[model samples]
Target: MGFFDRIFGRRSAGIDDPEQLRRQLFDAAARGDLSRLAGLCRANRQAVETHFPAWQKVPEHLRSDPAAMQSHVQVLVAIAQVFAQQLGDASLFQRLMGTPRDNPLMRWQDALRQAQERIDALEFTAARELLTGVLSEAEGLQGSGVDELLPITLGRIGECHFESGEAEQALPYMQQALALCEQAGDADGVRIYLGNLFEVHRWLEQREPAAACARRLAEMIADPTAKRQRLRQAERVAAGEPRNRVLAVIDGASYELDELPPLAAGHVRFMFERDRITLRRATAANEAGEACGGEGEYAEALAHFERAATADRHDPHCRYQAAFTLLHLRRYAEAESAYAEVERLAPGWFHCRADRWLAGRLAAGDVEHDVFLAVHALQDGPMAPDEKLDLAEKTLTRAPRLALLHLLRGTQLARLGREAEAVAAFRDGLAGDGEPDVRSRLLVELATHCDGPQERAALLRDAQAPAGNLVAAATAQLLARGSAN
Candidate 1:
């Protein structure tokens, strides 16, 4: 019928039913009726010897002696183990043996190990039953020295519920375990329970409680670097709602950071500073792009928006602005590519799908613009200077109205050592209604090659009127030079 039945046979070893024999042995041993147990074993001597050869060597007098019942319990436990392993029915074994007292802690550990095995097999009900029974026994021994085992048993019972996807059911058990651990001053146990509570509350989407648990766990961490990292994570999870709560979390994290070891403190501080700089740069570029777009300076807006996107690709709004500005500038292919990225990053945004469609339609019909072609060629750093100049000139011929094309031609001409041609091209682009930042950049370039003091001063002053890092630096240098003279 079953694997065990096939191996042992239905009525082998002279026992008609192994299950009935197991029960009689348990009853006799539990009642301290060694006389009855010996009688039964003697009647089923062949069955006992066949299943357990060691039992044949046990002296007959010891079998009926109450003083030697501890040995009798061991034999019974061994028999129960055999049935549990062969029949895969541990209920009778667990009920009959409970936890052996020959070596109480070792017996408890064995029971826990068996329960874990049952859990691993997805036999959650069996695991829970075993853990509950063990917990009852452990609690009963509270007045004994075994009181320390109660928290561990309670935690195991909670683990059974947690593994079974009954987090709500697991909560009270974990809380009780935590209380006992606290009462016992078990630091490791407290850390473990807090960590478990954090996971449970997070899975339940109870953010506030989860955050509280996270904060407690962070406080329990002993390693300086690990503690700082955990505190940072706790700060993030605790973020939201009333300003006071958020501030409290941040302050707590900051306090922990101050307590970090010197080397770890320096490393974390460097990381924080780098992140802050990156965020500030991205924000400034995004804001500058918005300002330029508001003033209808699409070319300058596109430059700043691209910078913003490069600095922080996670900012969907920056990517979208770059795409929109490219659309206004009639760079359809670039706009389409940018919109595709926006769609990927923010699929559910209200305008993403519509904007993607519009960009796709525009890009399908429009020819590649000369400005885009020239910029692409210049981006190929290995291209010869003459080839770049040719590309720039071709761009100017096709889109004579685009000021950036003129600037491109000027820069390429300057690189080719044609200062006169570069100056003329820069002035031509400066005359058109391009972005102020672009105009300032052109003036700075032109001023660098100017020979006359008056002309250089004028170019620097004009460049200083616009806001840009390069323009500001160039203007300040020239002004300081003039003052020195």
Candidate 2:
């Protein structure tokens, strides 16, 4: 059956004597059919006047005044309430008395309240139908409170459309509501409408419009804390766009970061910083051709790193990492050049001098002393004892004066369960004429491997004398604490 027919039919079945005049009046009032109610009241005027004192004045009020129609509905509701009590049926009473008032503003509020309930129950179709009728009735209203009720009604209609996945259709209603709210100087209403517009535009993928709404929302908010929240929200919306698009959005608004409130300006500054970092990292990754060193795509990785270095010329870390990657690829001359640029940008930020020395050795075609293979291999996976031994042997042959290589060899031997060979390797490495940094590092390694307390103490003491390497001094202090205990 049709919707209203089914509703009336079910309600009519409950009343055994449906032909009763009071039952007909109750049904018309319950359905909110003002025309049918007026007709029924006119036809039964003598009975209504005699039975319901309050309703006797309604016919005269309706004929004399256009604004008196609300009072007429109230009288009908009173009559319905009496009939409901007599018949012991509260459904008619509920329908007629739900709104509790008969003014146009209250009627609109009642409709909105009912619509909200329907929405909460996931009855979108029923909510939409109710909101549509409310919208029509609200538009016809022309009284003091109409101005206040109309915008609210419009906004709610927009919400109905939005919640029902018709955001495109919601756009115009929200925009009209926003304009009305602005004209009425209703700040809260304006914010609500603007929020609706922003969400709708975002759902439609209209990025610029959504960002504009967010910006307007931020500007309209008066409270500092609330303004900051809106500004952050705007920044997040803008951040989803491409770099150029974000820049365009900021520039189009003609707002300098410094011109905003302190919290808003802080958010803008953070966005700019985040964008710079993201762009730099992305450029580096794209140029490198693979995420981590390009997985043997050394030439492409080098090209990407070089492009990254050029893209972010002021960032020393980018240049440094690029140089490191080049060293892995054994492009020693290019690695030397990149490391030199890093030193120029951030002097003494890393062990650049030592790195340059190694690069120079590789450039001379001396593969025996190359540490990149062992280092890169370690990055790949854990090394076997024989692999570490082979690397150590090759490193020792080409760079016997490199004390760190001896320490590495001794550490590898110790890990292989060959403590005697490890001890011998550490002693041999200690005899090398290396720099103070290398000597201190070797001493710390030997002290860690040594079992004899006196020997360990002597090695730590030698390492502790080095003022340049804080790590060795710290290691000695820690080892001394253990000995004392």
Candidate 3:
């Protein structure tokens, strides 16, 4: 017998399916059938599992998660009210749901991840709604152990607003996040929030506060030359002078914050159009990027790369370099987009998939700066492969644990005529859950390498997915060639 069965000695919950129970309970309540709802609860006092009633269907992760636990307690209170007189026990619900204060953090994780994907699609409004809901939940955890989550949550909401061209709306949240960071003595957090505040304030013509933020940033992140450079921007903002390197007209209403330019000296000039500044033609060499960035001139290096990539959307190198430079500058949020674009432009680009993975982690504030830097610094260096084997080896070692990377590795090895190693790579990539399209492609590739007709058919079957139009077409073409099921 289960724990609940033992506790109540075969008292029938009578409800096997939680979904049907939920429907019946809600229906009963809607029609003012209080007695029936109470009757249902009393009948379900001892389930086979300890979950007793509707709680049985909840995943173990949700049942154990701290944030969900708190919500569960709230649910217990309402249930107790419904069954209070019938069950004659107020503490019974507490025993079922556990003690609760508030913990909104863990409950917000899945929503935040989904929101990041939405943000990646430039669906700012939808992403903002998701983030704002989480932020509202954060209020319930004010004195709880998870209050540390508040600053970052607030900052993300601010970023959503900032990216959607709502500076005034972003200001208060940014300021609050910064203040929380200050209170928490998070120096790095303070530096980041201050940089963001400087961007918003200067754009909003709140120049005095912008100057203050700039000066603070200089104290935090500047080298000697960069120190003087930041001081100059601070001075300009303080004096309400026209901001430097902003090549757009200052009409206030239509002004957009493009890439954050350098504080003092800059390499390339950008022509900011009405909505955004698109990169025009720039003939600067890649070596020039390395040189300029050597002195921690990341802003200028970023500008150089963006310009080089403007009309050359097909060139993955420029976009990858720009993303790397943004990472170096600690502009993680922007780097996420840059790296994502590179991933789309060239999925097989040199370390693009791996770095894009890191960029997401960094943007979500999930990875430490030093950790991200260490991983980034160890990139597969300039894609100069002497042979396909070398390229495959490098890709497997340096790329993210993504099926697409392994697929590339496998394809490269196959081209080099290394059949055994190629098959191994394909199998390794398919070992975990992955993007359906990439997984389908990897499975299709593996199918072609199999010796037996049955094995080949099975692999092809595994590769075929509902959304994989390309893979489905490829599979059909292969099947026509007599590798049939």
> Root-mean-square deviation of each candidate, in angstroms?
16.4, 17.5, 26.7
Q: Tell me how candidate 3 scores on lDDT.
A: 0.62
Give the TM-scores of the predictions, in the order they appear: 0.32, 0.38, 0.33
Candidate 3, after superposition: displacement of residue 375 in Å?
A: 47
For model 1, what is the C-alpha lDDT against the true structure? 0.62
CA lDDT of every candidate: 0.62, 0.63, 0.62
200 Cα displacement, candidate 3 (Å) = 0.6
Q: Which sections of candidate 1 miss by over 4 Å?
A: 1-107, 120-123, 143-145, 223-225, 240-485
lDDT by residue (1-485, candidate 2, tens digit) is 56754432322222233237665775677676644555555455456545554333345535546466665565566555544543344554555444536545677878889988886765666887898887776664554466777777777777777665566788888898899989988989888888878877766657778888989988987898668766875776666632211111132242323343222222221111211122233244454545656466666676676665544444555666677777877678988887777556554334454465557667887544246566345334467877877877776777777655676788778888888888888888778755455566678877887889998888888886632244455456556655766
Number of clashing pairs per prediction, in order:
0, 1, 1
What's the true lDDT of residue 469 in model 3? 30
How far in Å is the alpha carbon of 286 misplaced in model 3? 23
Candidate order by TM-score, decreasing, is 2, 3, 1
